[model samples]
Target: MIRFDRVTFTYDGCARPALRDVELTVDEGELCLVAGRTGVGKSTLLGAVNGLVPHFTGGHLQGEVSVDGLATHTLPPQELAHVVGRVGQDPLSGFVTDTVEEELAYTMEQLAIEPKVMRKRVEETLDLLGIADLRHRALRTLSGGQQQRVAIGSVLTAHPRVLVLDEPTSALDPTAAEEVLAAVTRLVHDLGTTVLVAEHRMERVLQYADRLVHVGDDGRVREGSPAALMRDCDVAPPVVRLGRLAGWDPLPLSVRDARRAARALRDRLGDAAPDEPPATGGEAALTARRVRVTYGDTVAVRDVDVVLESGHVTALMGRNGSGKSSLLWALQGSGSRRSGTVSVQGRDPGDVPARVARGLVGLVPQTASDLLYLERVEQECAQADAESGAAPGTCRGLLDALAPGVPADRHPRDLSEGQQLALVLAVQLTSAPGVVLLDEPTRGLDYHAKEAFALLVRRLAAEGRAVVVATHDVEFVARAADRVTVMAEGEVVADGATADIVVSSPAFAPQVAKVLAPGRWLTVEQVDRALAGAAAGEPA
Candidate 1:
């Protein structure tokens, strides 16, 4: 069992405590979910469990934190490693070896285990995580999802009684997220290991959590079962949102449960007819004709021909290293486009002046918030808007659209990762350019914020502002994308309507696709419509 007793932590140089008077617990063999926006003491709490908070972090820690009857304050992280197997949010942070199999074995070797035992354990964990195929792969070559899995697998090889994972799926695509969660579920059910996970993607973890612990920015911890707690929390899952809208008894936690309630609501209230598809043949906001980009001797994007229609959302969908980012940069005129033409409203992106391009296209790069150097959120937005030639008050209006009630005085750097992303989005969108490019906009967001972001993207598209997102978030693609483009090895391999391409293509299909009756079932709405159609056709 792990317990925190009124724990408050302050970094050595900081004025504020990262965590304040937090109390939480995880029972033996229990699966507990630690949830909140990013930087809300979730990572700190995980570090505290492993003695990395005050010990390695050199922080002023008050109160007690214990793991398995051992006080973490008294034990060094290395000493506590025997009981705690931690997979940090940053996959690179916990690595000790260069290869997948070797990384799995490294911890056992550190514990002075027999080589034969280490090898057996490594093999078992690789097979357990369904990563035996990647056993010989170099750590650097693996996709973010694969790297995260290897990180988790490496620790699991130690067979530690307690496993703490921090946002293990942040970098994963939807299918890959499912694979990781499946393995984690197996660990709790089959191995009887106690599991504690910190994540923003709550929907992916909700079904597995025996208990939910919500951590506030002030470091207050609230613990209860997922059903009871998330039902009341404002930032709950879409299924919860549907439940709230439909007025269901005993709020549903999963999509499957929510579907039944939705069907019942449809029976009582009558399903709303589907809206007509938006008009086609608007002016092309952005176009890439046979676009190719190469890095040194290697090609990153090859002959990718595509067009982003004005006022539509186009999602670039593919696995990591599939040239999604390359395509986005090419469209935004940030990367070199060789052997092809990229145009924004008939103007060549490469030949157009930077100031002219700024008016035509705005890009929110992946980790774009890292570019923020401002002290306050509002000032940062205003400064970006002014520099971009946007009219005054545009930034404030954009912020109001993104987050209506958020305080502008809050430090931009101090905001949660999700909030920071929204802030950058406001800065970019305030210019109201012909096209907006978002690279992995939903990458680090939790289930609640992801749903909100999806809504926002749709709203932008509806306003006749072309929006393009390069992301592996299949769930978001299903909800927000009008078109899906699949890239592999720096080439455009597939492009079509979101539902048709993702559901029909085996490689790019999300995990939810596997369960749904195929034929363009992408979003929950699509699934519902499909079910409704089937029901209407059946003899009653």
Candidate 2:
């Protein structure tokens, strides 16, 4: 259904070709997952399907890309709207309607479908994506994950033959991500829709993918089955990594397969207990008492009381719309708080100036690009250094450590989602705030990038800074976080050690923990260490 014939595309002002001599084909009714490192042209490849590359993005194209036998080189995006539907990384930027129901119906209206058919499709899509409860909510009022579901539903309502999704589950919680993926699989299985999705979180989609299209660093693409490609792919899920570590032939792609192969390894473990996270003993870096955040009649956070300790990493986790973002914003002293008292270093951040707040607490919000305004990356880094009284190149150094190879002259807006996140993190960390808050920081990061970011978070905590990351990436939480705080319906539901909380919950457990059940293992590194110790005839 989709074909790329020796297609090569290069953006204006860049000598390196984003895609070079890419020849690929996607059969009808197949689900193809595009995998690659951050800023490695996964999005560029997806954009080519509907003529968004050379036509709208003003890039040079060689060769041709076609969908349903129609050449995209000759047809514009508008001309192929009936056959192709796309959902981008940032859902809010693509929204045109105010309410959830309206957004879902807008595409069908544009396609000139019958009103009855549009209404039916709208209801089906709402149910399919499990967004029936959000139909009447305003788009701006919904959480990021909710907005993402709405964005996908809007495109699905059009019933396009080929669905192109960019990070479709990036913003969703574990259960919600499963629901969205399930819906897409149904489309492929029952309705014969062709799907091409580029996602950073491979764990969620790898099991469902019929084919894997991996984009390498040299602008080359490799295509194979998931099990065949994951064996040696640099970017892979936790389960696949665990399979490789255990030397299991035909690397497992799902938790079930990994668990089945782990019986002998579990025997070898033989009651070796995983090391517990070190207990936090530092003084309180920030304290919140009776914090409440409301939007009109809806209460986002309700009288929440919590304490953040210096030299610790706390992961704030829960289902989507569970008040994680709202609570983080309230604590940062920038987002709306109907009634609350936040104390950072014995000073109320909300009462102080923005400059003072930066010293007290630094926040990398869900929309990291919103924090960037400068024309160039180097300028933003320099400004951050000057404003924070830090040495020049401090922010740039941090960016290099977190996600390397970002061009100095590139526009912050033009960077990929993961690169934008790294830049925002570098900008915020330059202030040397006592407390740091990151909301969905791993949205666009691949496995390797996430490993670097996890180390950076640990380094920040080691420097006597308290860090709180509000995220849905369970795998990341397992690797980076020392403590876990689960929220539900605007209230803290569970708060404790990371292993205890994540290992017990089925919805939030990482792949390794699921495979090594009956043990409190949270990450592959932990298991690796235990096995190594056992091999050396020492206590694991």
| lDDT of every model, 2 decimals | 0.76, 0.91
> For candidate 1, lDDT tens digit of each residue in 86-176?
9876686568788998898888888998988888898899888889999888898788778888998878877888999987887677667
Give the runs in model 2 whose Cα sits over 4 Å from its true position: 116-120, 123-137, 141-146
lDDT of 1 at 309: 90
**How many residue pairs clash in each candidate at the backbone level?**
1, 0
Model 1: lDDT of residue 502? 79
Poorly placed runs, candidate 1 (over 4 Å) = 10-21, 37-39, 56-60, 92-97, 108-117, 259-263, 269-271, 276-281, 294-302, 336-338, 351-359, 374-379, 390-415, 430-432, 447-464, 486-540
Model 2 earns a TM-score of 0.96
Name the lDDT of candidate 1.
0.76
lDDT of 2 by residue, 1-540 (tens): 999999999888888889999999999999999999999999999999998988888889998999999999899898888889999987898999899999999988888999999889989998888889999999988876778778878888877899999998998899878877888898899889999999999999999999999999878899999999887898999898889889999789889888889999899889899887687738999999999999889998999998999999999999988999999989999889999799998898898998798789888888888889999999999999998899999999999987889999999998988899989988988886899999999988988889999999999999999999999999999999999999999999999999989998999999999999979998889889999999999965
